[model samples]
Target: MSAENEVRQFIVAADDDGIRLDRWFKRHLEDVSFNIVSRWARTGQLRVDGARATPGDRLVQGQTIRVPPAEPVKPDTVKVKPDRPPLSDDQIAFMREMVIHQDASAIVLNKPPGLATQGGTKTHEHIDGLLDALQFDLEGRPKLVHRLDKDTSGALLIARTSRAAAFFSKSFSGRTAKKIYWALVMGVPEIEDGIIDLPLAKQPGTGGEKMHVDEKEGAPSRTRYRVIEAAGNKTAWVELQPFTGRTHQLRVHMAAIGHPIVGDGKYGLQEAFLTGGISRKMHLHARRIRIDHPDGGKLDATAELPSHFAESMKTLGFDLSLGDWIPLDDGPVPPTREQKKAMGRAHAKSVRKERRGERGRRRG
Candidate 1:
């Protein structure tokens, strides 16, 4: 078939299910750009099972995607290079030692605190750059499925293949993947176990990176926390289970409740520091993760606390003998597409109502 006339059809595999249409195109058709994809989607040139599709549409298994023909790639076109640099021998050895669990589909790493998951400006070394080392005679390098804060340590999931990556990514977005974190907070919560149902929005003027409680115009966020042990009301060992995966959700939520995680200078400020002999590292750790495997069965892994975290726990007389918490079934399920749309409409209506009420109060 001529390159200009070569229309293609693809069947969505189970691995690709729940991914956005634009992402699917980028993965399978690397030469395609977001602009081209968006243009096609807007002009009805892209169809899923004979129906026009949008870039934001989530694909499901066994659906047929009809891709319109496109111009042939020119041999002289500039190619995008891999963002990561080659790994050194020492870096390779370091990554290998961090592996806590490995299988054909995924690898779980006990990522240490201060090691960024992906490289950024001024970040010369990171797990993403060295993932090639974890290939270990495999067909392809592992891919990171999700991210933990640079200061947070523990179970970071790496998918061993494109198939595994898609599956795990969907699992996380669907909220089937459960994560439990352990944190040592500066103060204890008044309630031993309760939910923090606060809305969170990015604080402006901070490069939109820092989060703060903003109920009127914030995303709905919820977290379930339990105080496991307390050290004379000065510090407490807490387990945090976040139902929503908003950036800095756990840190901001804990701080909003007046029990900031120890050593969280950004959120906790002066209260983050402890005068006792405790290490000044962020006390939060990604203690455990449980998710359904792409190839059947379950994927469960737990990471041991980093040295500083363990030492602080011991010093505070918190029991390290308490094993990891089992995946909680009571956590909120992620809203489906219809549910999310309904929620968005409701939120818009509420915002309009609040604006009217504020105008009335101002006039009064």
Candidate 2:
């Protein structure tokens, strides 16, 4: 084979360490489409230290990656993404207004209701399209690490760099990131402070847009809720925390327990709506997010409520000062593998010592 067609190998560098295998290709091998990478991985042509590797696998510094020869691209057959239109001056201002917190590695936006996190069929105006306005002087556009439903407004995080994106993505997927939400439900839950441990799956015939509880064939889902205050037996103000990242998890769990979130007609049907000057918009709000930062320490951000949600809180006689007082966790960090191994050894030694002492007493 010619030199150009020969297989190639690349070593991970310090800067590229901890990034996903696919992200490495995007940074170094720009011509390699993700589909091509997936094909190579599936066919065992891609390897990390002689072991086949997938695109989502994390890369360590000094690891060697085996790559197959580049395939020729036909310009006529290649499909290209259409360029997005430039943001208008008003659009730029609107995005800027949503910025609640910004740092070197992340940007937190207070996404308002009626704005989609990402664009889909017939979805033109969305937070993803407006991301360019938040780029600032960065070398690359901000990347979304997680998403909130279009109508479920609250704090949304944007990663500033590829490294931050990988780190934040792992943090979210591993359930290490904690998010707090404030919502108004139709009625108070019978169990004031409870955990909704229900499996969820997409409702059939909904085109994967809606979710429901499924006992046999569904992914495990859990949500913790605490009622902050209740307005008689009619309405309730509650705090929600999701332990698993399932589609519409909080919404489905709340509705399954018979206290559908107020204004969530999709799940609650007719009972979700509230009268007496209450807005028909979804009352769910992402209040805060706490995750370990890529650059050490933690990135904790809080978003203020939109006008409608704030007004609803006032109407329900809920005090704003008491909303954020609850701490999500006061537990210790989980032990690492090495720490667990050492603990195991210590435990065995203790057991051995206790048995030996009993034997000595019996012999005496």
Candidate 3:
């Protein structure tokens, strides 16, 4: 986080779940201090649904809040600079180019891991704030149709106008958007492929700064995953397609099944995030996407996994790529013939055991 005074943005999480306004911002905002948050609200720096709100106001879900910056004491005299350049021209240029496809209606961006899709007061240099650097015609201010976790790189759609935003929002709300993620979980699935249908309600942490799984009252979430490449000794290259998008749903769900994506801070093995294990980045990527285009058709987008991810893939014994799509007839390159054969053998044994048990019951 540099000392730049960049314009910030934030998303209001609804209060229906009983989250407090001040508390929420304190947790969500980066570079934002608690005292500053309080003063901003007192001075009407906070707005709810475009209206001012009190610090104690209970959050209503689905409301958007905006917190304006504080007036500088020595407005013109003080400029905060960072110790080091936050993002280089080459990096910014790289980011702009990652935007694979954009139209007057929508933008398909390959978001890098470690960058927030949107922004908050504490958030500096996020994808939302960098849109101006892009060489596209965003008819007006573009809004993120969805988000990827800071450490997860992948394709995300941005609506360029309010109308387009509304269109994308509706599509997401209706569960028509198809999102695919690639996770380098540190274990193989019990089955070759399966769907995890579990409800996820966010469980608050002791410090109220982290999240966990609470199945008793969790929201409905589902994920379909297949082992694309087995990296041996409890690790695999898995392709995940989430049906219901819950925050950290994919990561948590994978962990629940005895597999967690390597380098996932909250829901993963600590060894994977340590200095020696993985350099500095997480091993989760939003690989490809298929969504309804605002203009009439489908938009397919892909993002090559970042350098850190590619390196991990090599170390983990997975030389896969998000290259051109793999066709059905395409032979065993990733989940090669030997691996498929082994899985088939395992499945056949399970089926044979089940049939024998059924016969024994009939004989009895």
Candidate 4:
């Protein structure tokens, strides 16, 4: 083996206790796999103190372990040709800065708008799909923790191991994680603080791929909004706290209030669409996120306003450069749990019904 491929072994210590053997190795081995670990146990590729060990076995307070090098697999590196589409050095720096936080547990990123969180047939270098392409220690590949919309740029989280991934996966699916968004709306509301209780369903298009919002039979969505800036009848800066994390909850709710974001082609004003609306960019920005950190303390991360959003603010006459909002007033408190459950449930029902009607019309 070359010096690079030479295996490094270590003794399991007190710090490694409580975590599974597979997980411990995920932080140590290059290209670690749960399936491979399982096979190793059956075939004796792995040994604890020079003996076979099970996948679920946890290391004791002080345990001797033998981590033999993983059997050879496929080519380890992504062979990007020297002539692959040349990227500016600045662009590469931007990519690295996206990964905001990382530990043995997870990796966080500041995802830019207009980029898919993952890759598809039309997708190129999206976040999740490109995790392996990212620079990493000689340990394991990165994984995605959650998804942000294509046009919604902000704090995106990823996992480096399955154990770390499970925590976030459950947090998002169970509505424990909170995501905050900022949007420039067309007008201010009468109520300074209120909840947008709406249900959101995916409206399928002719191609049966792309997604739109429908009210028929959709998922429950709840958004709590507070006005941060009021720019007369032309526009307003608002912070949206999504309670349920439904698809396009903030956008749909703002549209429902007759204040679609400036550049939202989907739920935006038709005039804006005709006249290069919202400056040809979506106004929604994922601004902040709060989650319980696995190690300790709360994970409160924020993504600054991108240039497009700043330009939109200036174009809308919000005055000054980015983040120069003069607070006209502070809105109300966050939605209560009772409010979220009730409103979210109702919204989901309504969306589902609207989607069903839309489907019927398409069929007819």
**RMSD to native for every prediction?**
7.4, 5.7, 13.7, 11.7
Compared with the true structure, all predictions reach lDDT values of: 0.88, 0.91, 0.70, 0.70
In lDDT terms, how accurate is model 3? 0.70
Q: Which window of ten consecutive residues has the lowest lDDT sum in model 2?
A: 329-338
Cα displacement (angstroms), candidate 3, residue 290, comes to 0.7
User: Which candidate, 2 or 4, would have the higher lDDT against the true structure?
Assistant: 2
The better-scoring model by lDDT among 1 and 2 is 2
lDDT of 3 by residue, 1-364 (tens): 4324544556653212245676666556544556777787778767887787876786665777776753345556544655533556876687678778877677788777888877765887688767655535543556677888777887888877655665677778877776678777776777967777766765764453344666677676777888888866557888887777788889888887878788876777673453435555678888877777757998777778888888877776676753234322112223423456899999999999999999999999
Q: After superposition, how far is residue 256 of candidate 3 from its true place, in Å?
A: 1.1
Instruction: Report the C-alpha lDDT of model 1 over 1-364, residue by residue, as the tens digit.
Output: 8867988899998767777899898878888878888898899989998999999998998999999897567888859777766778998899999999999899999999999998887997788888999998686778999999899999999999877898898888877888899999987888998878888899988888699999788888888898888889899998998888999999999999998999999999988989878888899999988899989999989999999999998888888766354346554554644477999999999999999999999999
User: What shift in Å separates residue 343 of candidate 3 from its native position after superposition?
Assistant: 31
As for TM-score, the candidate ahead, 3 or 4, is 4
Name model 4 segments beyond 4 Å from true: 1-94, 133-135, 204-216, 272-278, 315-364
Residue 97 in candidate 3, Cα distance off native in Å: 2.5
Distance (Å) between predicted and true CA of 283, model 4?
A: 1.2
TM-score top scorer: 2
